[model samples]
Target chain A: MAIDPPYLLFLGDAADELAAKTARGVAHWRPDRCLGQVRLPGCKADLGLPDKTIDQGAAEGARSVVVGVANRGGVISEAWTDALERALDAGMDVAAGLHARLNDVPRLAEAAARNGRRLHDVRHPTRQFSVADGKTRPGKRLLTVGTDCSVGKMYTSLALDAELKRREVDADFRATGQTGILICGEGVSVDAVVADFISGAAEWLTPANEPDHWDVVEGQGSLFHVSFAGVSLGLLHGSQPDALVLCHEPTREHMRGLPTYGLPTLADTIARNEELARLTNPAVATVGVAVNTAAMDAGAARRYLRETEDALGLPAVDPVRDGVARLVDVLP
Target chain B: MAIDPPYLLFLGDAADELAAKTARGVAHWRPDRCLGQVRLPGCKADLGLPDKTIDQGAAEGARSVVVGVANRGGVISEAWTDALERALDAGMDVAAGLHARLNDVPRLAEAAARNGRRLHDVRHPTRQFSVADGKTRPGKRLLTVGTDCSVGKMYTSLALDAELKRREVDADFRATGQTGILICGEGVSVDAVVADFISGAAEWLTPANEPDHWDVVEGQGSLFHVSFAGVSLGLLHGSQPDALVLCHEPTREHMRGLPTYGLPTLADTIARNEELARLTNPAVATVGVAVNTAAMDAGAARRYLRETEDALGLPAVDPVRDGVARLVDVLP
Candidate 1:
């Protein structure tokens, strides 16, 4: 997909917080589309995008102002609302993945209307889904599961998809979260689905009877993340992936939203994921690890990857930097 | 709660199928509330309630017709719609726990309004729920987890609650499914909730305060049931139960809906439930077992209970026949 020339990310006050997830995603995965980033006052963190205010983005030919950060609880903050209004006022269309609708905020709604800009909610899937019947298909299925939320499941899946495609393989990417929806443009936001239909969403994305094909399904919350494990388990069961890539960030010490809970060991995570996956497909296995070493320097990242690979007995790669060739090679 | 007078249960043609779940529940849990059962033409098996045609129920002073059979996938069949119409035409209020809303079925809705009768959709929750924070609650919480769907989680929880209440203990029954909701008149339908909010639904049902009391939470699907395991895990984490009662139907040989998958052993289930629960509350433990011996003879039932008790080293009881006193004795 070619970059939609010059995108502006509205991080507002949360540029350093959860919304920064989207900012980092855009900067790293779709840098060609980025113009620059916007941050609240005193927020000096580099999001890898060009630093541009709403007006500056408009002047730089940005057609869309993407709400880059994903807020916890998906609530729209007042700061975010203000940034969105400014973007709309500057003649740019707005896109948001937050659970709260941008059209519901009156000021932003009016600004978009007056400026003739469109509103897109990436989290609201457009298609209907049916309940999964746990049927087996012909193609190979690969899933990326993480140790915690925001641990680069999407990044790993995308990298794997890209790598496989570059090798002329018949591969497809299935996005599970909103940021992934924004990146891929055509995938279900599985987390936004009703619990009864979550597996259905997975089934819809990875259809049956695709012989000799590979589907790289992006994963969601960790199997141990108390906040959203239902989505995780549903995706795990629905995907019915025979092979899995364990995505982990070595620097994170605790589970998200549960400060008292430490991360499970790599061996435990692999075992747990495999066991859960095996509930549907008994032949399920963990073939590789996708190490998120974005926080580490080059040497440290390599060491972490090597250590993870040694500890878990799987091929490991920092997919974003080193490509997913190593991980793909281990697939059945 | 006293049984309301003269209830007619609509079994339609599903008397021998999924609706049998509801039929069994009503017969075993609240038989006094039932006046008779309705089945389609050529139907012969008794659902434990006095078999009555629509006209017979009306003549017998039935004030309400309950949609007793929970069809697989919660589909409202043509026969069911016809039965509902007759019940409404007879001026009887109708109650349904199916996923399909009677209010959404045009003929049923019109019949209900025309006859000035009420339609109750039990599975649709009436209240809002936020995401669970996994905070420690003051009072003790005991959850009844099952080995499979329709394994008597609700029956076990309700029985335990009643036994505790009989003993003058401050115990409240928390319902998680449709039949439980119909019986209790309140509680979230955990499976109907959006994937991300399943945990939140659990949190809202059982609040954090109230020391010295006990909350008996009815569980939903099993942790090993691939079709609905997400809902099961969410309930487990959200309830944050200190103690659990493992509910099982020993006669079932395979996992529900999955023909190839064998049932997890009792030891494995207890260990799995405890492990998942411990993620939220380390103090969590399985205290007892609720054996659903509905499919067995009394002699065989007692022997099975004794065998399970010996193997797991937990107090075991048929909540319906034996009462839950032995189970309650093991609570923390």
Candidate 2:
């Protein structure tokens, strides 16, 4: 429970291979709270963080060490375990988003316990959820939908939440996946729930009657993605947002795992998402776009953003790079 | 386990309101095995089963009493429990599709045990399922998809299965819901599975590499039904059907819960389902239409079928009224 901030990221040798999805999420939303990144040799992506050794990071007031890269099969390598132990020995708490629990590894658990530090496993569901009954909720809801998976749903939602807070607007970010759970400290892994209860998990994440507040919900798989469409639809119905922000990764060529299906254009995505949202709330509207320009150059990213904004006639931004302020301002 | 059945259907008073879904399913697939119907005076829809009292049904060789109607909330009523007790006292096994388990009710369980009869709770999952790997299977898969909830998905699947058997074709029916579970005698309720494992449940139901047999998967909720779209998509991906049979009710005014969203035309439904099925298998096709003309008059039903057949240019049949022989012949 004592999961205070000032975190050191353990990207280690895995940084070059995997996307470091979890670390990127934390850096995007709580940049100032991050102390530095620790990587082994050949860690290519800068991730906009100052490189620091485990001792230097701990000495510089880092209270926790986060295993930030989401490796395939969620496995923690022996090298990563050594780095985690070094951080634990330095009296820092340890947190992970991997399916392989850090607590289950006796060495990691013992190291943490010896230092009187807690271990946080964020992918595990922290509470039970009821079935969604499709009832109308009270407070204004904002959902971030993507044209493809792993675009920028969590980052956009958190950026919007941060922007709203900066503008003195009452807003909250609700996470629905593993990485989001690591960043937000709480969430139901909607994909892990029973099919009948997926909507209920969505509904419980954003309850009705929050006075003047806005719930910026992180979306999951795309409705067009063959592998995870059910999870996508459940989250869509559960959020029942009054306004939506469509997220698109400009470089992806086709839907994930479904090479036969092409990605929908921004216009197609907006129309498709709005049609789904309207199933639960007739007045649901598309407010803006959150374009992921991670794979594009500065000029191309800006040009693409401008063209998308002009074509769709809506505010568009790389939520992490340009911030979601313009998108937040458009919220009604 | 010894659930031999010359079924005594407990229609009770619900027969006037809700259809005897379970009984109708059994009768459609195995009518010769059903002993008769037991109704509380004024019970109308004959379901083509002979009417018999509890004592009469037992004397005539009824070995099981089936709780037929899918009651609201799946709750077993006191009156229905009394009938179940009478059947047990007469040495007949009791089977139900209710969410409430017969084993959980001590009196029912005790009565059945005293008479050396078994209690069957069909809706509960009978097997564990692995996660879907999205691997292509060898045998062709055919899934029955509906335009709305409860538009006779099970009936269509069973009818096609029967037609294939009559033609001496190698085909198997795989159930995904409660009623289908009762008729098929075994299946994991896909809706009850975790969202991440829905596809896995589908994979386990019909594994790949069947040299010649066709798997007829029974679908659940519609892709457009807001409350249950997740279940629908999961079933679709899991089946990876080579061909899809679109089920539609001729008289449904709106898409289930969304009063504002109208039903898609037959052409639209076919196009939409094929697109989804193609996500996994590009060669997916729509072979026929299964029209539910249950609420129409005899002459009107025939006309509607003829018109739909002409408009779609596909084999169209009332799976229950006209059988699925023509539709089966169209499958590749």
Candidate 3:
């Protein structure tokens, strides 16, 4: 599903920046596609764009209204009906990554239908996917894997995509999660797909391309994570990446959410991921490391990066602090 | 959802035995659950049970009308509506693994509601599942993992459960797919679940039990199958199995449905599965090999089994021909 841009991001009564993380991601990565921001009265989050009504956003050439705030249950609040309907009436489509479907709200559904606009539920897959074929597609792919969830896989991937394009390379950032979808304006959340079609969805996200073209895929869950290794494995096999950037959070003591599980070493993580990846792309290689050093001081982060590079014998960098040029330099 | 036992099996114009394999599986594994069979006029398959009308089967104490035949596309046939309604009217629930929802058919919905009976769409999970917490539960568990798709994982699991019971071991066959669900009367179709909840559904299926109780989980796709390894890995992690039976089809040259990929060596499969399974269960062991010898002659199969045992240094048995007693003997 291609969500049209420029978007008027609606942060409806979001209590914190984390609630509006999707909007923030879009603004940071695709500022040109973001026309304005619309906030409910009690909203505490901001995307730093001009506040505008739906009519103003439409008049300013916004093509869609993105519900970028995530509530406690990822539900569209009834508080959003007026703004969503207004966006539809103003000739803009509405898109959201919510647990509740936008079409479930009769008023928004009717408004969209009346205006002949689409309602994109980014979290819910609208199309049926066949099982993965494990075919060897042309072109190159670089997938960002992690030692744990939320360890900058997306950040590393986007940075790599941007860096590759800067050097006159044909590259695309393939999103596999909600925030990444908002940033790219289109992508299926691989985690939300049916178990049988995880790899199929990934293959569809990055199809055969020009021989030198690169599809930098955002990864999900760790191979070492008991709760989500399946999603990771499926995505890995489907992505068929020639190069992988391992993302890690150095300060974390245990796996995210699962307090009892400890993180695997970067060596074990790389070795295991490469072994599993050989099923789809036998020439797959771990080219570099992307360390999420947000939890560390600059000195500590630098030390960790050095230690990781020496330990794994890969080019290591914090994609946020340093660019991904080195990582791209060793691309196969 | 518990599908009531003593079923009236419906083979609605099935063109071949393979189409009615689900019915045959139920009849074979749980013969006591079969009351009689209902075949449409052009039905080409039979379960070797007394032919009876829905009303006759209901009068004879059938608790549910099982739509056991799997038609092309897994859709509920229009021709079966008469039998379904008659069964509902006669005070019986209806269970099916069809892709089409039973409640979507107005007549079946009205009939079921009128009779206060339930309609179980076993392939589509109606209940919401949480993300897997990856907690350790008290129970002995055995999981049957395969070398590729359709390598008799469910068959081996069922055989082990039956044999365990015969040997006075407290065990339950935990079904993770549709046919097994019909055989066991209840299970979540783990592959049909949303990708994120694959492991969670598995965890829900086999919860904490008595220390001596064993949950023999039916496995899904292989660790090396590109199309479905995620489902396999999720099942492995969530199952937290102490012992794994490596199931394989001796004659298959390639992975199922994917001509591009070949099967991994049983040694690789066992090692990889054991390594990944260590994420949840560190002490997990590959206890034995379960061979699908249906494609081989008796003497050849026996020799092949002996060779496989020598190669892997594990007990190798065909669950159908030799039972799973040898596999059980090597259990952790």
Superpose all Cα atoms of candidate 3 onto the true structure and report the RMSD in Å to 1 decimal.
1.3
Task: State the DockQ of every prediction.
Answer: 0.53, 0.38, 0.89
TM-score of chain A of each: 0.77, 0.82, 0.98
TM-score per candidate, in order?
0.77, 0.72, 0.98
Q: Answer with 1 or 3, whichever has the higher TM-score.
A: 3
Q: Under CAPRI classification, how is model 3 graded?
A: high
- Kindly report which residue stretches of model 1 are placed more than 4 angstroms away from their true locations once superposed: A1-96, A102-120, A126-128, A209-211, B1-95, B102-120
Tens digit of per-residue lDDT, candidate 3, span B203-289? 999999999999999999999899999999999999899999999998998888987788899999999899888888888999999
Lowest summed lDDT across 10 adjacent residues in model 2 chain A is found at A12-21
Q: What digit string (tens of lDDT, one per residue) describes model 2 on residues A1-332?
A: 32468888778676553467678777766787788888877665556789999899889999888888866678877778888888899988888878788988889999988988788876655566776667887898999888988898887888888889899988888888877776765677888777887888898889986768899898998876766777888888888889899999989997776665688788977887787677678899999999999999999999999999899999999976898889878788
Q: Give the TM-score of candidate 2.
A: 0.72
- Candidate 1 iRMSD in angstroms: 1.3
For residues B191-288, write the lDDT of model 2, one tens digit per residue: 87878778778888888756679898998988767668788888888789998999999899987766766776788767767766776788998888
Badly placed stretches (over 4 Å) of model 3 are none
Q: For candidate 1, give the lDDT of residue B143.
A: 92
Query: What lDDT would candidate 3 get against the real structure?
Result: 0.92
- Candidate 3 positional error at A149, Å: 0.5
| Model 2 lDDT, full chain set | 0.81
